[model samples]
Target: MNDDQATPNPTKDRKFVEALSRGLDVLRAFSQGSVVLGNQDISRITGLPKPTVSRMTYTLTKLGYLAYSPQLEKYQLDSGVLALGYAYVSNLRVRQLAKPYLDEFARNTNTSVGLTCRDRLSMIYVENCRPAEITSLRMDVGVRLPLATTAAGRAYLAAMKEEERRHVMSSLAERHPDTWPELKQQLEESFRDYEKYGFCLSLGDWDRNVNAAGVALHLQDGTLMALTCGAPTYLVSEEKVKNQLAHQLAILARDIERLGV
Candidate 1:
């Protein structure tokens, strides 16, 4: 059999398979900018074929994860996805522990704060506190940012265990050539610098006008997520804010760690 084909594995094979993953991916493909998608759009966004996306959409609609607009011939994410994400987030130990600290950080800094965990090659927002100025972008709960672009994602990558870090960075190298450069030496140097400082600062790496800084909030299990702060570049410039903001974020992380948050 080819590598693309499923291997015969007695130990790994399971009777209770998961359509859950594919369905969730389809739902995730619908985002803030693209609220509804036709089969072709879904196919392009998800890398799934048109026929497979059509079948999944039909099944998802039946299961209530999607709702189809007959006039537009497009599918929009239904309320069911909220319930799924809500259930997961509601039960997460990190979200529970991070909320109060995030709130405090936002209030103290008078800036927006977010907590993000690694999800595949993306960073999934778990908690956030946005001041009105920052909320203008409508960056709210359940936002996923590219791991190679955002400060929180870079911070998480910087904090990853050795083997896991190699795997994720390698995948990023393969998947995003235009965005991800082939500069291995520079990447390693940046990671080392972040490790020395305990945080990472990104300037216009994700969004051209957005400046962000983040520090890892470590868990006892050796897993870590990031506490991130972001603003428009006009408000926080690259030359002015990287050191100060990173220090502040690191302090917050230390406090949270001491408090076991």
Candidate 2:
């Protein structure tokens, strides 16, 4: 059924609401970090009753948005979901607006450069460019990465409105129990740096052997995206990574801003 023609506020009605909202909630319970969830776990996470969650899970599995892992008895998002997300990005202004700049950065730096945007709580890769020599780190379009532990995520977080940032921090506290303290400190420092100099850098924080730097691509519409450069530790030192790449990053940001990224 079309979204506009679907039951209106069926959540208030006892009949159609069960299959409508609960199914969507079941799909939402899975994320980049939360790839699979058992019925009980889904119930706890979504605040839906155990039986309701069970029915919703079964329904979704039948509908192809989710798959049932018999060994784990957990549900995971299927590849079919990518069709929906990719359709949105394929038509996005950011992809067209940021493409040439990313291509130029990769050519100049001879390293990987990418553009990512905030999707609720995760960072979705919209564009990527890398040198032909680097064959290990295979980043694809539409790949979702956790924002709390990525340079692009931290940069986006730092650029958000104060209230939105608070909500993100709260959700991070709840979603990531192990990395909360370190992530919080990193976020604070990055935000300060971004505000002071309009760019952010992280070294070996997201992954122990990788380094990255990023700058905000702020558009006039209040929507923000981040352009980031990522490479191995040996290739990106603290001084050169932050001081040098930051300048190039700023120029790219300006170019994107002019085009409204």
Candidate 3:
């Protein structure tokens, strides 16, 4: 099981609202693959009692956060949830500010460019720009990738201060106990590469057909973000990524950092 599946018990906090947390748990139980969920399914996923799940689903349905189908006796997310996500994306100044630059870079390179931020043990894409021609790699806004495997995530790790990086690495070690040894070794190599090259490359590490390079920078608001360019492994050679794309991405990172300053 993925580490994200282990939901923390926020209710243990003094200021935590258990009901609100449980309600969110019910809403989050639905995902890309499991779009529709019965009360029992939600209960199992959230580790909540059946009665609690039933009530939460009923409330969510009434609030338009979930839509219930009478025939299948299942619930799916409604448009209201999208409004919440839209509120987040629309309010991000970094995304609004970076669009034109990222678009130009994508067109010039004929590859995909993305801006991502860390979300726990994952890197979540906030913005993505793609060239007209389609490539084997497919990434979009809101997509999440493992922090230890992707070029964007490695760049983020490299950008963090030493103490903070150590804290996050410890958390990752605890979360993915079995894979820590291998992941740590790979991360150490990435850190060394970043120090030497000003960017890090992931050649088919995250996805077998994807080759990507990325650099990290801070936004005007001091938010850490990574900008990445990616193409299919067949289309981009490792040498070209290391010697060319990495330098270009580093320049882009510096340009973005200047905007924030």
Candidate 4:
């Protein structure tokens, strides 16, 4: 059975391990707003067999990544998962070092500033700073956005190494054959804009409620990340983003990079 719940990895070599893949798919089955899941639920989500999901879930529970509920007869992520996620955040020194700058920028601009890192074919928010008064935008840490359409994702593609970007784009195109052409054109334009302004814009392109500009940062730790700053559409215009927010985000991205240096 094919397990393509998240992004599809286009190339699989002989070193690939199916069992490990299935196990990770089982974990990926637990998504945002998903509380608990039984083997059947995971099976349907991952397209794996019920028996295989049962075996994988049992193994995961034994390893402390999952906890079983006796009354509900389902499983939920446990401490092991939290530890892994926490370790990732803790090791990213940029998250701690950049927060103050982000907060200051967000507070001054009345916009939301978010730090994101690429995960597979999407970008996941690592740190978020928003003005307390702004309540329309809801992006926070752990929120994931599509790689092809988002300002953050386009900035990531513009900044990533060519070979790595090609690999990711291949998977994206293969997965979204119908939309890839248009999205690819937009990404190319974003690249040119990134060259001129050091930032990319998605003015209601991804979410109509949001108007955002993004820029990329290359940390001293060899990590590549993206930064986005935006407000709700009603509060910001495309010209305002290009003339104001974009420059602020680009400057913040450079300052954040200097911290890692």
lDDT of each: 0.75, 0.77, 0.84, 0.85
User: Residue 199 of candidate 2: its Cα lDDT?
Assistant: 81
Off by over 4 Å in 4: 1-18, 70-72
Model 1 residue 112 distance off true place after TM-score fit, in angstroms = 1.5
lDDT digits (tens) for residues 1-261 of candidate 3: 223433455656777787897898787677424878999888877678999899999999999999999999999999999999889988888888888899999888888999998876788888999986845566888888888889999999998999878877887888778988998998999999889988888998888888899898787666888989989877788888888888998998888777764
Predicted structure with the largest lDDT when compared to the true one = 4
Tens-digit lDDT track of model 4 for 1-261: 322223444365666777898898888788634789999889988889999999999999999999999999999999999899989987878888998999899989999999999877678899998987789787877888887788899999899888878877777877677888988888889989988879898988899888999999898867788998888888888889999889988988888777754
> What C-alpha root-mean-square deviation, in Å, does candidate 2 show against the real structure?
5.8
Once fitted onto the true fold, the runs of candidate 1 whose alpha carbons sit more than 4 angstroms away are 1-21, 31-33, 132-138, 182-186, 221-223
User: TM-score for each prediction?
Assistant: 0.82, 0.80, 0.86, 0.89
* Model 2 alpha-carbon drift over 4 Å, by segment: 1-21, 30-47, 61-64, 67-80, 176-179
Error of 2 at 242 (Å): 0.7
lDDT of 1 by residue, 1-261 (tens): 011112234456675344554565677677525988998898787777788888899999999889999999998988888899899889878778777878877776656788888777778788888766665544677888877777787888788888878877767777665755544444565587687887787777678888888778897667687888887877777865566777888888887777654
User: Could you give candidate 2's per-residue lDDT for residues 13-62 as a string of tens digits?
Assistant: 65665567667767767752587889988887777889988888888788
Better of 1 and 3 by lDDT: 3
Candidate 3 Cα outliers beyond 4 Å, as residue runs: 5-13, 161-167
Ranking by TM-score: 4, 3, 1, 2
The total number of steric clashes, by the backbone 3 Å criterion, in model 1 comes to 0
Candidate 4 residue pairs that clash = none
